[model samples]
Target: MRIFRKITTPSNYHHHQLRSYVSTCRAVVLPSFGGADKLQLRSDVPVPPLKPNHVLVRTRAVSVNPLDTRMRSGYGRSIFEPLLPLILGRDVSGEVAAVGESVRSVIVGQEVFGALHPTAVRGTYTDYAILSDDEVTPKPTSLSHVEASAIPFAALTAWRALKSTARISEGQRILIVGGGGAVGFAAIQIAVAAGCNVATTCGSQSVDRILAVGAEQAVDYVAEDVELAIKGKFDAVLDTIGVPETERMGINFLKRGGHYMTLQGEAASLTDRFGLAIGLPAATTFLLKRQIQYRYSHGIEYSWTFMRADIEGLIEIRKLCEAGKMKIPVDKTFPITQVKEAHEAKDNKLIPGKVVLELD
Candidate 1:
């Protein structure tokens, strides 16, 4: 004789139900920073509780970056604390394991890839990672998980530097220093895809690969003088290496008000103007000369890049891949246990392309 009351839904009932869901996932943890050998690979680290707009992913693969090595050795620790025994690894490709209550863009089991936050880098290197909905993008169907893993950090950085910072367009002459590296290779393709005239520098052996990637010319940094090979003004320069004096030489290559951007230094300046910060020698040069019209400043333009894992962006990159407009070169792959060796390979520049750690 039990009577069932008319079921009425409460507006907030779903919120409680969602919280119960994220309480159950595991991740790997890093005990300290030293060598990759210091990574503990724990399986009991708690999965982050999904924020209202976050999604939890079961990681499939991750790509290593040199920055990871620096972070592991405690180089940038002052700027970022490793919530210790933290997890490490930045680029991730995975399937949707779960979603927070407010997330609407993806469903469980959808494949995706993106850069994990510096703190979350660890979790991705493990079995699961929870990401803000905005930080994860749909994994391109055309690429394998390993291929997708390699695209996030390098590709996004190249995109922001060339397309966003430099604003390069068709017919613009651009120079990409360190063009044989991962980011440089991506830059060449992105610039060429926009119909720009591209030149890059690498070892002599890498010239053919660079040319095949659509660079109009590839200069061997060891055998040729990069500054002399081009012999004219460039609309933009994407300097990836941190050579101290290259910036000075790069200044000579820029047309009036031309943009110069770099991964490792402040914008290059030609004049000896004043009122600039103390750290940037190039800025000091511009200040000293007071080169009013010809001095252009850039480098603080890539803020949104840190949060870039947009599905639209990756989809666009995939189109380039499908059309043979870009190439994905995976130099090597390591098992999850060989994480330390992978970092050494990257740090020593032993690998030709992205080094990925395959977990699945």
Candidate 2:
């Protein structure tokens, strides 16, 4: 069901600004990795200069993800420490303000949305941001900037897990864990649209919502044992909640030769928990060992998914959204200045879908 049908251009759409005029922009910056208090609103941040094959976008809205919270808390301090005072957002929807010398896929004044690669120094939590042309596409005509901003990261994760990793085919049976969350919500729709029999597990409050998104069955994981509730076998199990027990249950739900995928992978290791020096390597080895062990025991493939930005995949998602086959579920919208409150809301599980930040 398409909740939003009337497609319109972003309200802030404007003509191109000359690249020669460099200016400062406002952004939410993480000065140091810690808690929500570390997320500071700074107005003097300078927007990056236009580079070849890139486009400068006047940010309209940005979506908050678990990754943003993790990054703010220094979850990957070992890798991201050198990039302190970083902007922490990925999904963005805005109007192109200027284009680089060689950019061709998009033009100034075009409304676009994309998930910025996580490695980028500048992220979407700003008044202006630059993105490589190949990483973005025209915003779906069926959604507004606020709604479009909520989509890219979660949708791309679902797309990669189902399309790239699972290679889901028509009539296949797929079980998606954590169907109440954004990624799981998107996975249900993408799988259902692909002609698969989709079953999902969520809270009792989320059952109706998950089913409304075309899930054939919605099991309340809080009330019942998921492994016992889902009957028969699934062709693939996509687990958005990365936990060892859940992963084991997912493997049990899968049929012989089926695939099981999780989002966390080895990042959630005991070594990391104990603050050991071998945390990273130990976690990687643990994941590898599990993958081999599962393959031999159950004749099922096991893999972890770390979602990446892919233009082709985003384009397919755009089509699905425009055609009313998929919908971006936004739970709440907050001004960029209220980023701390937004993060707290998401961390506290106060929203069913995405918590977005609207930029001026």
Which candidate achieves the best lDDT against the true structure? Answer: 2
lDDT of 1 by residue, 291-316 (tens): 43234342222111222455555556
TM-score of structure candidate 1: 0.80
Relative to the true structure, how large is the alpha-carbon lDDT of every model? 0.68, 0.84
Please write out the lDDT profile of model 2 over residues 115-139, one tens digit for every residue: 8876676889998888898778999
Candidate 1 C-alpha error for residue 182, in Å: 1.3
Q: Pick the candidate with the highest TM-score.
A: 2
Give the poorly placed runs of model 2, Cα more than 4 Å off: 1-21, 268-279
lDDT of 2: 0.84
Candidate 1 lowest-lDDT run of ten: 266-275
Candidate 1 residue spans exceeding 4 A from truth:
1-28, 117-123, 266-312
Per-residue lDDT, model 2, residue 203, is 86
